[model samples]
Structures are given as C-alpha cells and as structure tokens.
Target: MSSSPLASATFWLLLMNTTWPSHVHNTAPTPRGCASRARGSPNSSCPRQRRSATSPDQFVPRKAASYYDLLGVKSDASADEIKNAFFDKSKKLHPDSNPSNPELHSQFVELNEAYRVLSKEPSRKEYDLKIQHSYQGRQAFGSTSGHTVYRSTTTNDNVHYWEQFRHAQSPEATAEERKQKKKRNFRLVIYCVITMVLSVGAHAVFFRKLEEVHNSFMDEKDRAITELYNEAKERARANGFKKQTEILRQKHADFQEKPEF
Candidate 1:
C-alpha cells in the first residue's frame, strides 16, 4: 500500500530521535564524539557507566606477606618453635612433594629464607622488633571514621612492612654500646701508657750500660799506664845503674801523675 508523504516524514523523524545519545537530554557535559564512539556507545560516556566498564577482578590488588605470617608463626615464637614450624611448612611446600607444581618450589624458597632468619637468635630478635614497629606504624595510621589512612613508607608498599627494617635503639642496646665504647677507649689508653713506660725504661737501661762502658774504659787506661811505668823502672835496675834506676823511678812517678794516650 502507498503511504502519504506526511506519514513517511514523521516515521523518519521518530527513527532519528531514537538513535540520538542519552546524555544530550541530561544537563551534564557531553564527551567528544570519538571517545564516545570508541567506548562502543555514547551512553557509556557517563562517569557511572565508565566505572562499570571494567570487571571487578581487574581492580583486585595483590598483597605481600610478612615473614612471621608467611611461616605461620607468632612474633614471639622461640627458636625451637620457629624451627619446628619451618620444618612442618617446608615439608609440605617442598618441590619433591609437588613435582608437577613449579610454583611450590618458589613457595619453598620463601619458606627457607624465613627459616634462615628466624632460626638464629639475633636475627629472630631483630625480626621481632621490626614486626613490632610495623604493627605500631599500622596502628598509628589505621582507618578512622569512614576513611582508611595509610602510611606511605619508602619501601615496598605491598609488603605493608619495611623490607630492610631499620634497627631501633632500646635501653639495653644503648647501654651495651656505651660499655663497648668505654672499653675500647680504656684499652687504647692502657696501650699508650704501657708503650710510654716501656720506652722510658729502655732509655734508662741504655744510659746505664753506656756509663758502665765509660767507667770500664777509664779503669783499663789507668792500669795500662801503671804497668808501662813499672816495666821502665825494672829495665833501668837490670842494667846495674843505681842512679839511673832511681832517676827512672822518679820519671815514672812524674809520668804517672799525668799520662797522655
């Protein structure tokens, strides 16, 4: 059947109105045509619509584990407790137990590292201190009212704890440090004083030995002079000259008074 021109024009107008974007009717700002087209439809340009565009799983963030939590142990767990817990966890996570699962090997590696730190007394103490600090930090910035407040540490954000936890000072630590410093200073002073005493004693002994050598040289010189004079007097007597012998003796006495080397 042939329709009237007025009816055909009215039908085209209704079709065009139905195809127009929904945001045009609203008072909000309209997005660009290209962005609207790229979004698959102009109705998807609204802020509410944009958020629902992606799946909820895409926004789900991953979280990292603390050493104590990873090992399934309390912060105050003893060395024996830590060891037992580690062996129990490691046996299940070991790669040999799950040969088909490569991921278990990685889990085992992390468990091994956790054990390595917790097994030692010193490292375990440090770890416990770090965990305490982390908990305190979390408490300080915990959620208040309707808002969740988070502290932005310089280290790994996902871990929720410091990777290289800084060593904190306590009363015992301070006293031990002071005691060590004092001991070191005392040892250094003692070493210096001992060195000084030894040096002074060495100098005194050297001078005493030098004085003894000088005295010995003087005694030998005097003895040599007396012997030479006595021999000269005896030679004069053996020649059968009484006056010459007496003169020689007199000369010997004068020479003995002042002899030159």
Candidate 2:
C-alpha cells in the first residue's frame, strides 16, 4: 500500500513524460459536420456538406500548406517530381549546411515531414483525401445567390466560416496548449532546483576537504619550524653564543607577527 521513494520518483517522471504531446505534423480529414458548425446553421446537409460528400477528395486545408505547394509541384505531379523537389529543398535548408540558423532547420524539418507523408503510397492517398476534403469544405462557403441576388461574397463567407471554426476549436486547443506550457515550465523549475542543490552540496564537500588539507599542512610546517629553532638554540649554547641564542628566542616568540601562508 505504500510506495518507496524510487517508485514515487519514477511515477512522477513517467507522468511528466506521458503528459507531453506528440509533435507529429500529419493532418487528418476535417469532420463532415465542420461546415454546419462553421455556418452556425442547423442544416447538416448544407451546400458545402453535399458538395463535400460528393467529392471528399477535393478537400484542402485553407490555412495549411499543401504537400504540392511545399514541394513546389503541381497537384498532379509524379512521385519523381516530389522526390526532386525534396532533394532541392533539403540541400538549401539542411541545418548542418547552415549552422546556427534555427529557422532554416525548422524549414528543413517541415520539408522532411512533408516528404515522408507524400513519398509513401498509402499515406499519399490518405493525405490527398484530406486535402480534397478541406478544399471542398472551403468551397462550401463560396458565393451563393438567392433570387439572383448575392447574399455574400466568397471572401466574406470564408472570413465568417473561419471565424466560427476558430471560435469552436480555440477553447479546447488553447486549454491544452496552456496546460502543456505550464507543465514544461514546472519541469524546468524542478530541474533548476535539483541542479542548484547538487552544485551547493559538491562545493560544500570540496571546501571542507580543502580546509582539512590546509590545516594539516600548516600544522606540519609549524612543527618543522619549532624543531629548527630548538636545534639553533642548542648549537648557540654549545658554542657559548648567548647573545645569538637570545636573538633566536626573541624572533621565535614573535613568529605570529610575520605574514602567514
């Protein structure tokens, strides 16, 4: 019923790691009801919905870069064309070739991710379907006339659609993003505290050892000096040099007056 300290630490570490989200850039098809949600209308079979259902492969994300666009190729471009484009872009944006430039490195990563999805057969088909679905969704908001009078322009409709779509998605996405950011900051603070504690502990041990060594050296030096002084006194007494012995005794008595190591 009680966990050990190691178990508790491991639990927290795993929790921290588990809370981190995957950074994969792959996109999935927008749900079928997105258009109705975008328009704030109860009609599930709105014009966009009908059109999307009819041609789901025509979908494309309005806000995202298409694989064809990223690769600088036509939608109908061949696999070889995509490969060539990737090679050219990779050479230009590779991080090793452009050191200390983070922007270029990011671009290269995106490029590689795009290539990874586009280069595979099954993934390419899935990606194409999602792209078509997005394109059709965007088209769902295109200009429509009632009684030969246009209600809204394409640009205005698109603006309104995106506004509603963003409003719906914003709350949940923002909450998750904020939660992740706070978790990352908390992890960083924990790391800093641990580093500081270890550093202080190491310095304390080092200085304590240094002080001990210094005391031992000073004691040895003082004993050697005392022996030399005794030898000098005896030699002076044996030679009958009382004045020299007195001078040596006076100097030895004032040893603390001189500079110490």
Candidate 3:
C-alpha cells in the first residue's frame, strides 16, 4: 500500500524539523565571556561593561594658580618684596629640602617659574597685563552670559598655562608698533624737506631783491660823476677865453700910442 506524494512530503518535513534542531544544537559554538569580548563590538545583548564619561583614566587639563598667589605676594608687590618672598618660600619648598615628596617638588618648579617671570621688570609687566585682561574677560563673560565661571586656585603640572599668554605679545603686535614708528619717521622727514625747500626759496628771493637795489644805486652814482666833470671843463674854458681877450686889448693900446711919432 504506497502513500500519496503529498503525504510522503509531509512525513519528510516533520522528520527534518525534529532532526535539524538537534544537529544545530550539537554543532553550535560556546558563548564567550563578556570580559573576553573584542573592543567596539556591536553585540549589545552581551553583558560587556563600558567606561563612563567621568572615568578616572581620562586625562583632563587643569588651570594653574595666579603667580602672585603662588608667591604669597600682592599683585603690586615690589621686586624686592617678590624676591624676598621667593627666597622664603624656596627655603621650605625647594626640591632639595623636600626630596621625599613629589608634590612639593612640583610646587617648587611652579615657584621657580613664578619667580622667573616676576623678578624681571618687562616680564612682570607683561604678566600683570595678561592677568588684568583675564580678569576683565571673566567679568564681561559672566555679566553677559549670566553664568558664574569659577576659577581654580590649584596648580597644574603643565607649564603651558602661562605659555598660552606668550601669544599676547605676538609678532603681529610688534609688527604693528614698528609700522606706527615708521609712519612717524616718514612724517618727520616730509616736514624737514618742506622746511628746507621753503627756506631755500626765501633766500633766493631775498638775494635777487638785494642785487636789483645795488644795480640801481651804481647807475645813480655813475650819472652824478659824469655831470660834475662836464661842469668843471666848461668853467675852465670860459676863464681862459676871458684872459686872452684882456691881453689883446692891452697890446693894441700900446701900439696906438707909439705910432703918433
């Protein structure tokens, strides 16, 4: 008694359904431990743990304390006061004195840096300006944002906290100052050139006027001398003619008296 084709196919389907699951179960790989899971795996069902945003292993940069506060001196403290404070602090905080403590050694480095900046006149002024600018910025930001930003008084191991302000006196600022100085010098040169030109022109005009006056005076003097010479010659010629006439008359009278014999 042969079964129909539909019945035979139904029997094979049931057999495969029962046998396939057992074969798959026997051949399946064992589950790995959550600790041994690879990093960045997308299997969210696994009970693997993740680090939080505030994990201690993450690196966060800290702000440094103010130089004046570090040195235990006022912002307006004189050089001698700052020097004396540095010496006093060094006595306690020096790496040699506190060789056992690394924290104190770090503080000593900060102290040296603060003293190096404050001991010099130019560097101290620059640092003061930077501090003042930072203060003003904080005030403005707080007023506008309505948020109080807290500044930390703690020291940072990184020296880049102060190095950031080195950009405040950047080459761009120096170039601008040099440009202003050059502009002033150029204006001074122009003024000097104008003054010299005006003076030379004035001298030329004065000399020309003096030469004209001298020529006119010389012409007048030559005319007066010629007139005087002509008058003297005429008077001398008239006197000579009068004397000749007188001599002729006396000789004629004598001849007339002698001819009567």
Clash count in backbone of candidate 1:
0
When 1 and 2 are scored with TM-score, the better candidate is 1
Off by over 4 Å in 3: 1-63, 143-261
Q: lDDT for model 3, please.
A: 0.74
Task: Quote each prediction's TM-score.
Answer: 0.39, 0.30, 0.33
- Residue 134 CA displacement from its true place in model 2, Å: 0.3
Looking at model 1, the pairs that clash are: none
lDDT of 2 by residue, 1-261 (tens): 898999999989998777434443343466776754757465654444355555867775334456677778887788777777877776787667879886674455556666767766798999889777766765686533111212245575445434433321223444686798999999999999999999999999999999999999999999999999999778887767777768778889899688888
RMSD of model 2, in Å? Answer: 34.6
Winner by lDDT between candidate 3 and candidate 2: 3
Candidate 1 TM-score, true structure as reference? 0.39
Clashing pairs in 3: none
Where is model 2 more than 4 Å wrong at Cα? 1-63, 141-261
For candidate 2, the lDDT comes to: 0.69
Candidate 1 regions exceeding 4 Å error are 1-54, 58-63, 143-248, 253-261
lDDT of 1 by residue, 102-196 (tens): 67755665666677677667887897787677667777877332222233343434242233122211234436767989999999999999999
- TM-score of predicted model 3? 0.33
